[model samples]
Target: DLKMLYSAYAMEVLSDGHLNDDKLAALNQLRNIFGLAKYEAEAIITDVKARVFQTY
Candidate 1:
């Protein structure tokens, strides 16, 4: 469930070139909505960061 949520969030966040504060807030809200633990959310964010940066 969290993985699915993360994928959806990733698609949204990646639509733009950056992850701004508003996007981050939305991500946190999404994490809460999906009942993801803090660590799980952090892990998903970290992975996304890695992929985003890897493109550079």
Candidate 2:
């Protein structure tokens, strides 16, 4: 459930097709809040980036 929430939030943040440092930092904070490991957070960000790229 928390992962889902984090994913959704990540998608929202990435909707603009950009992941600037500020946004990355914000996502990191979210990742920490969700108790996700660093690798897990990277995986989630990578997945979201792939999905976004597919649409572009």
Candidate 3:
């Protein structure tokens, strides 16, 4: 539920093809709000980044 929401948000954050510090900060805040641990968020973000790269 929350994870899925965060995952979708993560993908949107990565849609620009770059994870700048500000974007990372935003993701961090969302992760905390969604109660997802840092590692889990990192894993989901990494996965999203990988999938995004595959399309390029």
Candidate 4:
């Protein structure tokens, strides 16, 4: 649920089609909330979709 909020924020930042600092931070925080060990910027989106969206 929390990650969903964060992903929404991340998506807003990504709407411009660029990964800015805010988007990266949101992704990292979302990953942490999911108990993911750690992830680079590019991989966190996939993790969120795989781990959060599917189950919801």
Winner by TM-score? 3
TM-score leaderboard ranking: 3, 2, 1, 4
Report the lDDT tens digits of candidate 1 across residue range 1-56. 66766866776696555888888898888888888888988887888777777776
Which pairs clash (backbone N, Cα, C closer than 3 Å) in model 1? none
Selected candidate, larger TM-score, 1 vs 3: 3
In model 1, the runs with Cα more than 4 Å from the true position are 14-17
Q: What is the lDDT for 28 in model 3? A: 92
Each candidate's TM vs. the true structure? 0.78, 0.92, 0.93, 0.42
lDDT to native, each model: 0.78, 0.89, 0.90, 0.58
Candidate 2: clashing residue pairs, number:
0
Check candidate 2 and list the clashing pairs: none
Give per-model CA RMSD: 1.8, 0.7, 0.7, 6.9
lDDT of 2: 0.89
Name the runs in model 2 displaced over 4 angstroms.
Answer: none
13, model 1: CA deviation in Å? 0.5
Q: In candidate 4, which residue pairs get closer than 3 Å at backbone N, Cα or C atoms, i.e. clash? A: none
Q: For candidate 2, lDDT tens digit of each residue in 1-56?
A: 88778889999999889989999999999898889999988888899889988888
Each model's total of backbone clashes: 0, 0, 0, 0
